[model samples]
Target: MTFLTLLLQTPAAGGGFLQFLFPVAIGLVLYFFMIRPQQRKTAEAKSFRESLVKGTRVVTIGGLHGLLVEVGPETVLLEVERGQRLRFDRNAVARVAGNPAAEGATPTPNA
Candidate 1:
């Protein structure tokens, strides 16, 4: 059929550049909207883990909340209950227990 023949025909000369441009534009959109934000969030989490200090209240990725008794290079000792402590990896911390102001707050009140 004539319609089939027309559909099989190659695109116009000037349309070649447009074909490549569409995929490149899509790549840029994906990088900015998806990949870039994830990278930034990961960096922030890493920095927070590195800067952790003793006496800070924190929650782990497993939803366990505790007061940081000791912060080592790659591990942290958490006082989950009075006279009861557990050790976990630095990366296990999800975030500070409360707000920014609670960073240095007394652990007993929050824990």
Candidate 2:
């Protein structure tokens, strides 16, 4: 009878350490896989936005492609067509088109 009580109590005692570590291991995994990469992406996007200037072509998040004709603190004037223009919030811009040095380079398709 005493041996049976001792054997059962040993497994319960071992589980206490695993229970304490489970949340910690989950937190570390989340920080590495989710939180850190998102922060890096946000910083890169912010820097790209701050570097905008006139005469640069850009694509908006909504898939609009245009040349930047004018820029303001809160808005940008875009020439989407030969004679048409549109206005959008600065943050709506997605990525700037590459400069002349990159014009001839072809992008490799992703696997």
Candidate 3:
């Protein structure tokens, strides 16, 4: 069969390594472009979460903005409105609020 003949053909001596090179090269590219950046961002988020203290304002994953009333080992109490407090997992704190510079520099809007 034609398929059997093609499979038995000898690779060119100079380019024989290309077959092995391509998949390894693609894997390296994927790690640098995708996996590495995600790991760095995750580490930054962990650092941000660990630095929290009482009285710091933050936004939750649910978009509820509040000041932190209490911080625990794995949870926090956030006061959303006057006399309205809700407990949330520490991971639910998306990011600290009111200081965009703390997360990253961004241009401010003007009207």
Q: How does each model score on TM-score? A: 0.76, 0.73, 0.76
C-alpha RMSD of each candidate structure in angstroms: 5.7, 3.8, 6.0
Regions of candidate 1 where Cα sits further than 4 Å from its true position: 1-14, 99-111
Candidate lDDT values, in order: 0.90, 0.89, 0.90
Instruction: Show where candidate 2 strays beyond 4 Å.
Output: 1-11, 98-111
- Quote the RMSD, in angstroms, for model 3: 6.0
**Better structure of 2 and 3 per TM-score:** 3
57-88 in candidate 3: lDDT tens per residue? 89999999888999999999999877899999
Where's the lowest-lDDT run of ten residues in candidate 3?
Answer: 99-108
Superior by TM-score: candidate 1 or candidate 2:
1
lDDT of 2 by residue, 3-109 (tens): 99888887544577899899999999999999999999999998888889999999999998889999988899999877699999999999986674765688768
Candidate 2 at residue 20, lDDT? 84
